[model samples]
Target: MPRVSQAHLDARRQQIVDAARARFASHGFAHTSMADIIAESGLSNGAIYRYFTSKEQIVIAVCEQGTEALPKALTPEAVAGFLEYVRARARENRHAQLVAQIYAEAAVSPPLAAVVQRQLAAMRAAVAELVPESRRADAAAIAEAFVALCASYSQQLAIRGDLDPAPFTAALMAIIRE
Candidate 1:
């Protein structure tokens, strides 16, 4: 057999992750199985196993792919737009529900918790970097609150469905301007 290119391998891996993400979002994590993922990916069992050793590994991969990087220049308008974008994506993909599920699972799974913590830490750092120099001393705390509020907004959308981002955005702007 001819050797597959690196890009091909990466695409295959991403395909598996995408399939797993869809399944996990539709069905809770505890309810999803490796067989479900394999079927969802339209790949054989061996093909799925080639990329991920187990379902847990796939779960971590999906979590690692969570939300895009925060914008470099954070502004109130930017934050509002970001929240609206996230809400729209959540409605389309049910990813916000999946994130809630991941948080629940992380509460009981140490390895998953570690991955989540690392991701949160990175997001907080990114948000902190966008803070004004005058707030540098409190950037860490500001980032924590900002990240937490954003997360809460996502969760609210997941549970409540189609809420006005106006209120959430207003709260976020308050944090950003404070």
Candidate 2:
């Protein structure tokens, strides 16, 4: 038998995660089964189990994939790039619904809820870093505005089918201009 490189292993795992994301998005988490993931992934039971122990484990990976490492500052150019990233993901993988599904599942699952809470805390910390020293008095408010801006886009994107990033990018740029 030949050995597989780490990149190949990671890619294989990502394939499973991508398939699971689509399945969980189209069909709610509770309704999505390992068999469904297997069919969606076109991978056998052994292959799937080799990567994730259960649906819960895969869901955790889904959450991990959804979360990005927030930069110290979210500048206008960065917001433009962010919108482009979201647009491409939505066009190719139904990214918005997958994220919505993750939140939906978290509401009912404690472990998933913890994962979400931790992610949100990390996000807040990152947003805080974007606040200028001069705005220290209003740092909390400023960070909250950024958080709300992100939440607004996320919620709207999940529901809107227009696939237009113009408005989103504009709004995000407006924040950066502030």
- The best candidate in terms of TM-score: 1
Clashes of each: 0, 0
Question: After aligning candidate 1 to the native by TM-score, how far in Å is the CA of 74 from where it should be?
Answer: 3.3
**Clashes in candidate 1: how many?**
0
lDDT of 2 at 100: 76
Q: What would you estimate as the lDDT of candidate 2?
A: 0.77
TM-score of candidate 1 relative to the true fold: 0.94
Off by over 4 Å in 2: 1-9, 69-74, 163-178
lDDT of 1 by residue, 37-96 (tens): 999999999999998999989999999888554655667678878888888888999978
What TM-score would every model get versus the actual structure? 0.94, 0.79
Worst 10 residues of 2 by lDDT: 68-77
State each model's CA lDDT, in order: 0.87, 0.77
